[model samples]
Target: MNARLLILLPASLITAPALAQGGDSPLDPLFTCRDIADDGARLACLDAAVDALRSETESGEVVAVDREQIEAAEEATYGLTIPQFRLPGLSLPGGGEDAELAELESASASPQRVIVRDTNGQIESIEGLAVAEISENRSGDTIVRLANGQVWRQTDDTYVQLTRSRADTDYTATISNGALGSHFMRLDNGGRRFRVERVE
Candidate 1:
């Protein structure tokens, strides 16, 4: 840590209890050591803090997930409503990645599928997902299982003409967010569209 960082630490370090409640960083104590005037005492505080952090991490109390892992998790649980939790030291994308992300604002076709985003920068839709399986429930509602193991069931009464003649890449699906937290799944063949909710 440099002198400038030490000088700015106190203003940003929140209370430990508040940080725990928010699932925020557990490095508050380390930053608090910035207030120590004696060099030896400050070093001791930092060493203790680091040891405590390591112990917590080893015990699984504190998790450390990188940006790529988080992004992959986000993609996996894209349409599902899950609890929001963040690990400490998780950083936002850098300026270089930001420039690449800016280019993704518009949907572009490439070898890899492009994720479309809305004006607010939220993921608008995910396309080119192969339909792994299609089944109907007792109520005759359409249930779709994608290659990624995401299971979605039809919520509305709209009848979706989906066939299992050719599974996998033969039928592609696009899932996009709709108004009022709703999601719509559209199929490539016949452009069949239906409202769906992720069941698993």
Candidate 2:
């Protein structure tokens, strides 16, 4: 994994909850490193407490805000931030290759396909497509293309055939099942449309 990805790993491992805290809330638990009779015992106790709290929060048995408060209490007592617990080797299932393959297969099987014709002389396919760009005509109909290569005249959510672009040329297209309840594009590009069900 990239070093930058490591930065997000810690944040993702630890949940951050927005909880209301004021004088009215109950006092937080404190773990004192100095309280132990010996140096080794004190360090071990502190480590154990922090690990236990982190595990509970990550498992959703305890919320993140409560954990934060606990850490705050420990910090106040010890004047040091406890080492946060993280699951080792956490990763997305199947990685990017599997995800791309799934997307292509879904698009190929979709009923609605959007085709694209680029200036180049190569052809590409897009499946599981959604609206990327819209150029308006005088008739108020929109020329919509997908991440895949299916193009159609869309009046509203429904699309109708206007003109088909030649496939021998370089272009990109996309198709989508639109089977998901809600519609959202990919976070990175905001163009690749994937159903929540398909993605999950």
Number of the top-ranking candidate, with lDDT as the measure: 1
lDDT of candidate 2 over 80-187, digit per residue (tens): 112222222222222223333233334333345433323541112233344444445687654544333223443243333233452322232343223222322231
* Per-model CA lDDT versus the true structure: 0.61, 0.34
Candidate 1 lDDT by residue in tens digits, 8-104:
1111222222222344457888889878999999999999999988886666555554434334434554676642322223323211233333232
TM-score of 1: 0.64
lDDT of 1 at 188: 80
* TM-score of each candidate structure, all chains considered together: 0.64, 0.24
lDDT of 1 at 71: 41
Off by over 4 Å in 1: 1-23, 35-37, 81-113, 116-123, 161-168, 190-192
lDDT of 2 at 171: 30
